[model samples]
Target: MVDLRGIRHPLRPAGHGRLPAPPAVDRVRADGRRRQGLILGWRRRATVAVATVALLAVVGCGSTVSPTPGSSVTAPATSATASGAGPAPTCGPIPPVAPPSGLDQAGWWRDRTFYEVFVRSFADGDGDGIGDLKGLIGKLDYFNDNNVASQTDLGITALWLMPTFPSPSYHGYDVTDYRAVNPDYGSLDDLRELVKEAHRRGIAVILDLPLNHTSDEHPWFVGSKTGTGPYADWYRWSDAPQGNGWQPDGSRFYYAAFGADLPDLNLRNPDVTAEVTADAEFWLGTAGVDGFRLDAAKYLVEDGPTTENTPETHAWWRTFRSAVDAQVPRTLLLGEVWDLPKVSASYVPADLDLTFDFALDTGYVGAAQSGDAATLMRLMTNVTKLYPATSGFGAFLSNHDMNRVATQLDSDPGQLGVAADLLLTGPGVPFVYYGEEIGLTGAKPDERIRTPMRWDASSPAAGFSSGAPWESMSDDPPSLNVADESASNSSLLSRYRNLIHLRQLHPALSSGTWAPVASDSSSVVAALRVAPTETALVLTNVSTEPVSPTLSLESSPLCGRPAVFGAYGQTVTIGPELTAAGGFHDYRPVATLQPQSTVVILLGP
Candidate 1:
């Protein structure tokens, strides 16, 4: 058995409290990984009883047996939690929040959960070892079967495909032909089929449009090397290697912000901008995709001395956005602006529909790793202020670029689940990396982080392909694969599924207004997600030790009795009177939060 008792919280200070001893419950341990079992003994029985009573009280079932004022309504822990467990907690159904008035149907992406897929690493088709459009089409049901009641699929509403354009590299970040699909991935017809299938299953497909640069072998880049033809001025060139990002091309040099092989396009040129705009329209109007995830959005047009987020870059985006909007007004343009939240927010409401929250990504991982909630709380509040009310942002834990959340959190499934809870419940649209739901672990070296998906544990390629995979599978254990986790309800994958469906079911989570809930302890982070009609209180214990922090819902309009949901492991009591501190109602969550766990309490009738 994997002894989790010896595992220390990375951010826990010296002499910090440790988790209580495991209970005498049936422990389900996995091989070569942290223990995947909850130690429910006496606490499990008591929680079930309290939850049953609480449910009756919430539904007004005429049960006189009111739960004792401070009686805990503990929830079953994830497979990695070291606390009480039984079945998932039974809670009242969360009322759905109505969409805002005059909300465009094209903006449907705002409330949907997005899944990012590296098509080359997702699944192999045609027995070719390489993942193709056909392979992804075959797995459409895995993302969303369009049957929410089944609860078997990942419940993904949108898919952000990482570059399908023909490219010299396996990763396809550097595009060669914008019009054609990569031969390895299949034909253009195959892409159309994938989009059709995805739409049939209620999944929106968004292609990764790397318009900032193209492969050096691209005909345009090749022609530009000779400094003649329509493509000559399409790329930025210097007589002799200019400044940073300029690469040697024969005797002359060209600007390549990403790398030498990826030559940056001169987006300042109306011809180049018009060409990219046409390509985007082709995909949306012809290929029938829902949107495009614009790669390197901030570096589209760089001025001398200032390479990123230049005024010219914003102008380029506005022009591009207007062109795309004119062609297909429904198209969602999500940008990959890897910068601070302020810089990212500047692109939205005009330039792009949404940009990834790079700051929140780091803040979420940092909060989880450090067992502190202050940073994440501050970031969420800032996001509310920075972006316009009409704009949306993409919230995620980790994407294709950084270390996977499982690895970032030391492969602790409990902490991983906590991060998912925050992402799904916090605000804006949540994006899940392809293998993230299954706890796929990888760090750096690019290729490793983009390995084949582990569909099953029986084969060397982990059922990713019958043939040799282009890249090896991650080092995560065989048991951590999808096939095994899909069978276990308490698995990390299941936790993600539950959270996603919860977000889908409640508007408070998907499109709610965010506000920080003041908590007494640094180890616990609390926030309130308020919709027009409903409110959700999200509390997370980032530490290894259980905490029962007093939360202040100050100056808020929360009036009804709260119904508890998710992995909460304690009784919650609302103070009848408002506290003197800012005249805010004091909510004492009497129940102790299990280490590395989160709970959502829905308030409002």
Candidate 2:
């Protein structure tokens, strides 16, 4: 059937799976028209063996949850009693669950906060009307204040850059040259300097690698079309054309699962895998990038219905991971699996270090908007069990593929605070999309969602670029820009900064095991984070009206001191309430939580 001579490398292992196909959308034309396009995807698998160092040894254990300029709201004098208290609060560490089947116990990811950057919209160093590497270089201080005592930096430790390689498309997903940087962004030297500067501030840089397909204009595809040289078998082809992607090319038909100008790489061909692997090595070894966001990972290898999550695909990822780990032992591999948690989580313990947690994204947003605390609490409880104990997902509210979060929550400041509280306090490595901190909002047609970062409201271009932006800025920049929000004590930008710092300060909130504290109200999602040294009770009132919900937990006295809070700074009081049948203590608050507010209480033993 298929030739195996080139691919059956001795070190390569094997694996398999199936994923629901992603919705197919039109590829944007150079003229900006919507036409049928290939699906952009990301793939991943595990390594046969970890070498050089004990992966578990290099990674540290634990996590923390965020902060702002305002003071924490103090609790009132009244408290709840065990006998009158409704549901008894569940206290203590949740049993240490087993790591997902093959989870690599590399915990280094726990300490990093990933920030997604769409290069074209980030900042423009040149007056070419497009954001470039030099512009990103200039903004490094914004991410880290360079050891400044003020702590004004965004404090993000990892950067997930959308594809940086040369491509014919504006999105850069249909890569034309794997080894070179797109001239629109900058030169290879510019990228090197960017990486060097980022590392100088203790930040890790990871480039998005689109490995599923290449621009039809790629030399390998052109060569393969003629069935000449080693490139002859570099892409999928058939004499009797079949399936959704079959397209005519000279004497034979080739497959393009995404854009018309893109051709799916025939990863079954060992040469293709070898070449892609080499490209990764170049970036990791020569370019000095920390890792990669594997784009379009699901469509790596097709089997019958579609080329997604097939056994061969997992096997290839394993080989790929091995090659990368061999070069950089601590390098991270985050997969872009835009599927359900069950489907995406399947890639972990072996395949990827993390997958974007779409469940939490949708769950938190939905519950926050509708005040359905049960749904949010259920999602959190389930996800904690689904993922490996040692590994975690990329907790995010919104990314380039989806509508901006501010747009999702209709720009409600309280809903935004609830979202930030859920994501930063929950267990996982969180990624904040650029401009999200300033409450950026955008909707469909794609370009709107990728608008330029709003750095200043006073400037005509919002301080993102001196020249015209590649895309227009969001209309409300004057009120929502970073320049204005950074100064306000109660602004969304200040909220995000404070929240991030909160996590950096507390180890329990970040890496600790999560246990849901039973609450009687449907409007509030309350839970406790328990670590060896500390315990915290997090409460969110997803309602628009002030509601006082009882939080029943077995823990001792709550300090009545709010560790971190958002929304209306109402006073909260924790007192003894009625007891349940089990004699567990009920903790009810004396103060009402204002609509859309969240509070974190540090409990004492």
Candidate 3:
């Protein structure tokens, strides 16, 4: 596994291993009542006596809800309003957004928003103070309630669950049993139930599969240590310690890329390949997961001294892809090739259905931090040229391994909003880390980055658990927790909810050709999302000063006036189109973007 912290060392302390059996507590069902409590609490806090004119101004056309002062943008209205006219929204079945033209309807992952869930730190259903499948199951509605009209849910279409297999470590990366579920999380049956529930809400579930290595305590590694058994040769070994990654297993040294506790599996062995392939089949065919987030995909089959992006790695992925396709036709293989766009793109259209764009992630975070849009604009232009299509890449801000985006931006909600706007509006599938919506802040040392989800600010455990949390909650939960933010229309959570649902409502924003829009100001980044029947103009002012960028949309396919779909402290003015000598219409669009704000405009037929 490539070090997430940019350090090639074990994240946990030495002697860190499986946690002891949790003390049994009464199982709490994450049912409608619990979900209602969360919504009602938000309503109670947000409700205020206001003028009728203000209410009318706040609720715009097409279910738009005006955000509070200093908030980011307009969000869709949810059932749980400040008025509290009905029951609070709950976790329940939600329908998937319809696929746009040229996209496969069966490939439900495309044009969808995905949420990365670290199961252990998500929620505690059994009062064990650790997140489990049952807890996740209850919270599925918070991700997507399947109601097109409801704005309470996050409107995520897919989930990328961190490893759930039984392992010897807390992170669950080093698998001990590929087939069995981690007892700390739940049973295999609980996993099946989770898949069932998620699917019922039209949410696709993909597991984190670290095929490169297994825990040293695994049977295969245990048997291979002696260099004699049915599992002999299952792991690479040598008479002497070969190089940097080799660890002493008695007299013989074995390859352990991440650490000694995790042994690299000899995937070149045919039997090992077959066994791993079968394990994948088990999850798809039996457990009913939709796909896998292949961890450290580029380092799967290392060559001598060159342990990353090897030719053998591509070949093995092809073999794995073919085998999985033969068994399960539409299963997704999303790889984590944490490298430049060129290297990450090489694995797509053949080896993996999609790969995370590490370069884009850097560009996005950097632009937000520096407030200079030139680098981000250049990167987006290059990305449009490099990838096979927009769907081939996955765009994200920060993940569990990196410092939280909020912390990276120094907890500035405006900058956070700008970053989120770029991620959702830009091409490729977007993945949101848990608690990112409410601007949860955390820095590295890994555990802090993967802290418990802050459900309620007032709760002792931040509403993640009735008992003690697996890890301490992030520092600013009082202002950043879900309950408080859900109530405030101007909160970061509202901005995220608006942006996510806006993507769902518009096809071009989700799956369309990206073309850069030339802007006069270096602080403003602009692009056009063009589809057959729809076109969207996304403009962001990365700087802290208002920028009225004169956009050169001469090369864009847009024609006529465009309407504002969503705006945050921005106003648009459509400039007159001029006919050029080549019989082409040259269009100019001008937008006055507020400091650290974004606006989405739609060009209709």
Q: List clash counts for every candidate, in order.
A: 2, 49, 3
Measured against the true structure, the TM-scores of the candidates, in listed sequence, are: 0.82, 0.79, 0.81
For candidate 2, the per-residue lDDT at 307 reads: 69
The stretch of ten residues in a row with the least summed lDDT in candidate 2 is: 51-60
- The RMSD of every model to the true structure, in order and in angstroms, is 12.5, 15.3, 14.5
lDDT of 1 at 528: 67
Worst 10 residues of 1 by lDDT: 8-17
Let me know the TM-score candidate 3 reaches against the reference structure. Answer: 0.81
> Where is model 3 more than 4 Å wrong at Cα?
1-106, 559-572, 575-591
The models' CA-based lDDT, in order, is 0.70, 0.67, 0.72
Q: Candidate 2 on 437-526: residue-level lDDT in tens?
A: 889999987888999998887455788888887788886648778788878767877767666655544445555557677887888888
- Candidate order, TM-score descending: 1, 3, 2
Model 1 agreement with the true structure over 471-529: per-residue lDDT tens digits: 88899888878889889877888878767765655555766667788888888778766
Candidate 1: misplaced stretches above 4 Å?
Answer: 1-104, 559-583
Q: Order of all candidates by lDDT, from best down to worst? A: 3, 1, 2
